[model samples]
Target: MSNNDSIKKTIIVTVLLCIVCSVIVSAAAVLLRPAQVANKSLDFKRNILSAAGLLEPGKNVDAIFNERVVTRVVDLKTGKFTDAVDPVSYDQRRASKDPSLSTNLSADEDLAKISRREDYSVVYLIQDENEQLQKIILPVKGYGLWSTLYGFLALEADANTVVGLVFYEHAETPGLGGEVDNPVWKAKWVGKEVYDEGDVAIAIIKGSVDSSSSNAVHQVDGLSGATLTSRGVHNLLHFWLGDNGYKPFLTNLKNGEA
Candidate 1:
């Protein structure tokens, strides 16, 4: 064969190899998608359970989730339960970018610095054996120092007292802002009050919380050496727990209307 003929053959072989590799990758992705989704869902449920203090080692997440957790959709502005949307299929983060499902936030209302806020959100409910609601887990997210942090905040039935807070995803400097995921810091939020007399009062302080302070109930010790990240957490908590987030739903819950 001439040099040109050999080059053509080589080119054809390379093209065919590329095509085959692409097909294999695409097929693998399609085949693995369902399992990926199931695992993602399981992880999410496990986080919700953990936030509610219900997760146990060696327990089946799906079984425990089915037995104890109920998912509900809430209209953020009205604070009312709505059956209009399916909780299991709704994506709050995606909705925030969809004009019809979200709204632009004014500067004053956007403490978390999220430009748009979803109108509806999914809330997880944990109930006791008698079916009495024990805790409500609300999904929360906001920009931290370097990246957005996504987490679950669990509150007592009263809707004001925090049961637990956990950030499952974030990109921040390790040992600093990333400390938001630190178990010890998260534990500080367990008993903190999110609201004081109907106002969003909970704050992440710059230093250790003063136990003797009158507002101790509303304060959480900030992540040391990560002031920006701490402020991000504080602002996001206030924004979510405030009127722009879940305040309406919580208010209705308090009034026995939800």
Candidate 2:
């Protein structure tokens, strides 16, 4: 074959390959997106129920969430409450570009660290019947030992005490830092205080809890060897719930402004 003809044939083949690959990817996305979204919503509901002490692995999470949970969204900076926007559908990477919804943070903030771009965040507020607030579940993510750890933080009605802690996604080692998901360790966080007197006081100590301590924070035994992972959780919690994080919103909730 002539060189010119050969080159033209190669170009045609390359173009065809690109088209075929694109079509396959698009088709797969179309077929899977719905199921993916449904699973995501169900998992989110399950996490919310778990944080509220209602999740049973074998039980119906959808029914429990539907019956007991009331979800609301709030502007973190202005501390103003708002109606629910679909948390699962709201994309933070896109929302961050909207100046009204996002608060400015340093280079070190988790949202800033892993984010390709910063945007407004979605906060899920869960309340029980009688209009009594049980736990304020915040969507939080941060760098862990190996990857970004995404989880929910359930703060008690006081907005300082911790009701429950659950990490629904992460990449830490299974036996060590991954213990953050273990029921035994997470259960220890049930009654802990996330802050003290407006100061961030919660910590994950390397050693055992000292009974002589007077702080309201509950002590969870750290993993036998996952020091870095434990510290990552400690720092992530302190950073996200501190001055640069959700403190403003929590303050408003405590004062009845929210």
Candidate 3:
């Protein structure tokens, strides 16, 4: 056989092909990163709009978001708005992992099962044409049955009534835990009250909410056959709305101090 047809030559050719493929893939990834980041940011803003019921079909997400939403950073400890961090670039999830920017939670204090909580959170505000607050969308996350569920919870101007909710990311049993994505289940969140006399009264039950019950306004039907995921949702909501979470900030918002 010719030297070019030898096994050594074949191996050299194969190695060269692999190296070329790798280099091409690396270059493509580098070139596409900016677009990827932009798309991700757009998707997130779209999710925020959808959570607040502001998303319209066939409309430009970026234009509608910029026109209707204002972003602010809140000090979780003081429940007050702060300029310490740039609201536009601050990332709560990333901050939560930083020791200086977050606090470690004890078992009893961490109902959401998130080990560390960020000191400040980025909150989105929807306003009327007259500049009055219409809705406040807060980002929340916690451990679910198999993965962490990240989502937004939008409250009305009163800060007690639910406007809407939508999870942007999660991995759970498709028919069970993943039912959180179901429109019927999500619609149930609308108009529910998050507080009863300064207490976080919201809950997720094993079955459907009883409209006739006095407590119905605070209760939501749990995900069928996904008790843990349902419980996680309840816990995360509780944590985010409680003292260690956005409660202080929300109080400030209610008092017009935020």
> How high is the CA lDDT of each candidate model?
0.90, 0.74, 0.94
Candidate 2 local Cα displacement, residue 208, angstroms:
1.4
Model 2 regions lying over 4 Å from their true place: 1-29, 83-88, 93-104, 107-119, 216-218
lDDT of 2 by residue, 1-258 (tens): 699999999999999999999999999999999999889889978887777677887878788777777666666556667554565566664665565555556566543244322333566566656777777887777777897777888887788778788888889999888888888888888888877677888888877777677852545567769998887788778877876667877898888987
lDDT of 2: 0.74
Q: List the residue pairs that clash in candidate 2.
A: 95-119, 95-120, 96-118, 96-119, 96-120
* Per-residue lDDT over 88-195 for candidate 3, one digit per residue giving the tens place of the 0 to 100 score: 788888999999999999999999998999999899999999999999999999999999999999999999999998999999889999999999999999999999
Candidates 1 and 2, the one with greater TM-score: 1
Candidate achieving the largest TM-score = 3
**Cα shift from native, residue 171, model 2 (Å):** 0.8
Which candidate order results from sorting by TM-score in descending order?
Answer: 3, 1, 2
lDDT of 1 by residue, 158-256 (tens): 898899998888999999998887888888988899888888899888789999999999999988899999999888988998878888898898788
Q: Clashes in model 1: which pairs?
A: none
Candidate 2 is scored at a TM of 0.79
Candidate 2 Cα deviation (angstroms), residue 76: 1.7
| Candidate 2 minimal-lDDT segment of 10 residues | 111-120
Q: How many residue pairs clash in each candidate?
A: 0, 5, 2
